[model samples]
Target: MENEKETPEERRERLRQEEWKGNPTGNLKDSTHRSSYGSLVDFVGGMGWKGTGMLIILIIVGFIIYFLFFS
Candidate 1:
């Protein structure tokens, strides 16, 4: 068995099975609904204050630009 070679597709399938075992909940998108504020808090909590601040600033600037020119 040690001398036998695995095909590329077989190796890929084995790796995928191992990853699936580690994460039994493969459906990561099946999350509960959250309010906008709650979602924002969760995002900030997941990706530190600096990242969250930059995102907020960008969103504010985008809205301002939209109102000034697009609207």
Candidate 2:
């Protein structure tokens, strides 16, 4: 029998499914497979001053775009 090689995405999905099956409650606090944004939020929150600086920069950029195009 020829073994079918799984793609990276397929492997990731399979692993995610296995994780879900192992934890039917879907409680993210105990799960290792956090969503990308959840990981980002956790990282930013941990950064303290650096996180605040990034957020301020993002808000400034948003205001610039809004005034240039929308207003």
Candidate 3:
């Protein structure tokens, strides 16, 4: 600390750069979020049953894989 020599503006800009280094945000809104809840419900309901069936299929397949390949 005693030997540090950065100017205040340089220090402030460095701090700003450091603060911004790891923060990432999407540059735009998802098209999905732009829809109303009613639309979302309709969209999700349209696929909900199929997705649930697929999930069950996946769980069964995963168990098969575990026994055949791992156990």
- Listed per model in order, the count of residue pairs whose N, CA or C atoms clash below 3 Å is 0, 0, 0
Per-residue lDDT of model 1, residues 1-71, tens digit only: 84258865456557767876787676243233353235554466566668878988999999999999988
Tens digits of per-residue lDDT, candidate 3, 1-69, equal: 722887654575566556556442321232234443334434544556788689779999999999999
In Å, residue 2's CA in model 2 sits off its true spot by: 63
Q: Which is the better candidate, 1 or 3, if ranked by lDDT?
A: 1
TM-score against native, each model: 0.42, 0.34, 0.33
Please estimate how well model 2 matches the true structure, expressed as its whole-model Cα lDDT.
Answer: 0.68
| Deviation of model 1 at 2, angstroms | 46
Model 2 stretches astray by more than 4 angstroms: 1-47
Which lDDT tens digits does candidate 2 get at residues 1-71? 22268755456556767987888778465354675335654465556667779888999999999999997
What local lDDT does model 1 show for residue 56?
89
For model 2 the TM-score comes to 0.34
Pairs clashing in candidate 1?
none
Give candidate 2's error at residue 65 in angstroms: 0.3
**Model 3 accuracy (lDDT, Cα):** 0.58
Best-to-worst order by TM-score is 1, 2, 3
